[model samples]
Target: MATTPHAFETLKLTGLGRSFGGHAALAGLDLTIRAGEFIALLGPSGCGKSTALNCLAGLLPLTHGTITMDEKRIDTLSPEQRGFGMVFQNYALFPHMSVERNIAFGLQMRKVSRSETKRRVTEAIALVKLEAHAKKLPGQLSGGQQQRVAIARAIVLEPSLVLMDEPLSNLDAKLRLDMRTEIRRLHQSLGLTTIYVTHDQEEALSMADRLVVLREGRVQQVGTPEELHTAPVNWHVADFMGYRNLLDVTVTESGAEGVLVSNEDLHIRGTAVGGVTPGGAARLAIRPEDLRIASSEDTGDGLIVAEVAVVEYHGREFSVGATAKSGTTLYVRSELAPQPGDKVRLRVDPARALVFAADLDAAGEPVAQTALAGEAAT
Candidate 1:
């Protein structure tokens, strides 16, 4: 990592889009990245996160948009000319080259002086704590060590911005956690502006200053982790953020605080989002952890009485799968264990629940949503 803070201003993307034979891979991506800020592009597969990253890295040409760095246009520049360092998912290391040589390759190609190249390579190795493996080839290093070399190779250039595409996806769970800390430490120590792309919501939440959620080649929402976790802009984003129970219902009332929605036998009041209106069809989202087992003595207006269909002990608590009288499946987490076919009541804090307009299909019809109760456990 470099010792000095980055000196660049904001990097702006206006209507950034990419198309492949008329199919839009990325569309209308408008974002401003400040110097030394860590931003994460998060979504599931085929959600255009990698496409957005490639466009920023200058590896992909824009169909219609502009990329500006410090008020200067950079969209027309080549990858090397833009001078942005990138770390790929597969580690992209030279198998025959030693770790030290791999880190020095970029400097050598740039025709930097031999003394400067050696000095920077030494510093980069020390920055990633790969001194012990400097002389080893890529083939001899573990997956984590290879990833460190890849990171070192990128940071050795001391570029103003760094882009990482799922760099830790290949590592084991423990290594992934360790590298998350390492990456955050490096970003802070070097004051490097970073754009990280990951499908893992936990990884993005833990490491990014802000997160951009994408769907079908468009940006859905951009906010801090807390903002996105507590108040997603729509149902698609809420589903991605771990709200597993989605039920379709009709809105009975709407107000400043939230809205009241109900089906045949169940009624719920939750925070209204995505322009939900009274008398309109809507979807309700609830996290299993937020849905708790109601005690026998507990009486509430928002109680959801159901019959438990399955229960699994998850170390700290039990995950109960229940079906309401209306045939809607519900998943809830509780400290108490309940057997199958047992009658129970579930309660959710209205503040923690979310409600959005019903999703539509290609024909513009409201699509029926189903809740897979098993997903709450994982």
Candidate 2:
């Protein structure tokens, strides 16, 4: 596939919001997308990622705010008038139509010349490497093939912006991985500006140039994959970004170097974030891979002594579940296999640990003091 020309210089969303029956599904979404950039909307279900995609696609009307491309407002336009391509999770292909016909449908609807439509469709089919399957009906093709047809259909129109709403959700795990590569390749080869919606953190981190994490219809954080993974803005974002161990602790010391937090029987130092204050309650987040069994004679300042409850082999390493003396459960990945009932000293580098202000309830009390064991806080 050859690189297509760049589209608009910038697409801006100002206070972009959508509501359903007085309940806001997306609100105050302010973002500026540069042309030819791949952006992913990442979050768990009901986080308004899909709502934001739909609003961008013109499938849903905005409750408030505006969307503009290169300073030209487009929120008031119709879906067709917006001239953006959309690929849905279900593929949304016409079962009765052949792959070629499906790919040609949009061009046909636009009243493109017969010769031009056929040529564009041929190019699209080749671009997706589906020339052999072009004559096959949607039901006759595999899930991955059907998804390629959907992609071909969208790209044939040469739309400036492409919107995808969980497009790989229906595929099998292997197919999802394969399609991730395929979609990324096409986006790059086409020089497309894409906004993708997905709940999968790995998918977003792997494919997008930048990620926008949403929660409860609000933007939580927006940054590159490395930025979010290395330094999540809050505990919630940390939990979503694969920081599987989140423990409640009280900050004993805070400084430019970081913060030292402690719970009964456990004291750890971690990078302070979200304005953690000394003597205040905080949440400590550590990724499982970063937490490992400490070597003998390698006594560390933040050593956590735990009794291994289980150890499962993960081919490359062992996934260990342990209970600290403080009663907090911890998940760690280690090269050394520690059997159940074995006592181990776990350690995490201060750079790998993150501490944030504790989430507070409406009553100003710390919310859910228990740790999130091998799972994100939801």
Candidate 3:
């Protein structure tokens, strides 16, 4: 459906950093949140997603850097002065106030006239589809309903930006999924410029227009879900994006199609985002789903002999754990659920397997072949 256009310009966070007594929580985060864009700040715990959100909400002081909205500096503004709406993980609605009152509290605090406050509160409730529960207190509502109310309260102010910190994290799995759709729909309808901080990969991938993946207070990769999933720039990002099989391989040959890499026990040719030259050390990244497992009798050009370690039934397919002849453990998802200790052949599409520089700055280096392998038995 067509929706109203966004009113604001871009919001820029430049060299954003927050330090506490010589220890840095967020270090030099630079992002440009375009108007009407939904950006998810995604990372594991302590990756500075929340810290960045807090800084944007004016809840935390920036140790360094500036925040600009429409080319106007606003990092020094207080939370109220910034006039941004915030939704917390725990629904921070007033226990004593009804839904309408909770949504109208901001307007009341701003000393808005009663008629305008009522009109805005009505619009917000309708936007969240909480019109039926307008008179109910937060405690009387379900988790999802309460969260809708929280969202209504935030949007009632008609702020230029909206900040959400794991807003659906408190709900059950199904509720979280439902809210993901709801939030995305509301975002488009309102033409909101939102900054969502979420550690859940699925949530960020499904909702955000773009994702900023963070690790150790640094931006690892910023791209669309498909870009991050299919082409991780580094081993750490590959790992984070669920590239479970990471093998150390030395480049024995390089060509236009891809590079040929070899380990002590196996040699394979694969592609890399960056050029991998001969006589260079690199790590090969392969997703479990991209791996093919079959009987040794199956004819394949690049099959590697392996022994199945375990198999796990994942509803649609089986996740098989196996060790290559080179002793590199890997996980393979297949329809044929191979039993434990079964001798098999492992194969991968040359294009599906990605290679990264060995010295690439991974979040944490895997110590063994099984370091990132999945353990499951079908």
Candidate 4:
């Protein structure tokens, strides 16, 4: 299917800030969206991802800063004037209207000619593979099919950009996966620049070209999926990215070998990429998969001696919970199952761990923001 050619100007956001009741919901955000790139706004609930999306859609007004597409200012424009397509979690289809009519609603609102609207709507239904159900009402279709109608509605206008807010959240697991593929396929075929807001890490990581992680109304980190997964800026992001263990330690040494960290009963050398001065407080972040368990007889240098406290089998592997001599709990995943009440030594490769300096935010708490700033400084 052919789409109308777009002007293809980059969308630029600068110092985007939004507040309600004098409380900041999004603050000082800067981003550049390439003409055809897919970006995800990812974070936990209340992390301002939805707020950012609404600001872009002009559904909500920005408290400060500017949004631009090429040379025109867009932050001040109404939602319709922006001419960007939007899909919401609710499907938002008119129950009384047929799929084809729903898809034609936007074009009709814009005073497009009836022939042009019918032509675009037909292409859109085919684009989403909903041609067979074009005359059916939304209620008669399956959840996934209804969502396709919503997507068809959005794309029938051939808007310059597309914004989606948790569009697949209502679907079942299998359906969600199927729709993810469908969305990616549509993005590629249409060459649409898209900004997707989702709390699910897998959705963001799998679908977006780049992801922006938000926290407490601030930008925490922005990078590709592999970059964020392999090397998170700090403990917060590491935790969000599925790093199961984050241990508090003091930096004993920092050099080419790595950042050596030591606690009461643990010593680990992790990646030294983030800032960590020797003799300073730091945090060591490692995934459960990276931690291995060995018997006392097989112990090596720098092994963490701990007592197995719990064991859970997960088909292919065992998730072992162990307690160190210092009473700190650690989790490990191993193919070799271990029984509870067994003594074990934990081992982690230095290259598989990440260490970050202990930096706190204004509330006197450690956060991802400082970790990103520390990395930037390095």
Query: TM-score for each prediction?
Result: 0.92, 0.95, 0.88, 0.89
Off by over 4 Å in 4: 295-297, 307-329, 359-378
Error of 1 at 216 (Å): 0.5
Model 3 lDDT per residue over 262-332, tens place = 88646777897675668877889999999887554678456777889988999999999998777778899
Which pairs clash in model 1? none
Question: 265-303 in candidate 2: lDDT tens per residue?
Answer: 578888988787888888899999999898899885889
Note the Cα lDDT for every prediction shown: 0.90, 0.90, 0.85, 0.87
lDDT of 4 by residue, 59-131 (tens): 9999998999886898989999999999999999999999988999999999999888888888899999988
Question: Residue 187 lDDT in model 4?
Answer: 93
Error of 1 at 17 (Å): 0.7
Clashing pairs in 4: none
| Candidate 1 lDDT over residue span 105-171, tens digit each | 9999999999999999999999999989999999999999999999999999999899999999999
Sort the predicted structures by TM-score, highest score first: 2, 1, 4, 3
| Native-to-model Cα distance after best TM-score fit, residue 116 in candidate 1, in Å | 1.5
Model 2 CA deviation exceeding 4 Å by range = 369-378
Stronger candidate by TM-score (2 vs 3): 2
Q: What is the lDDT of candidate 4?
A: 0.87
Segments of candidate 3 deviating more than 4 angstroms: 1-5, 275-279, 295-297, 323-329, 360-378
- Candidate 1: regions farther than 4 A off: 309-315, 325-328, 361-364, 370-378
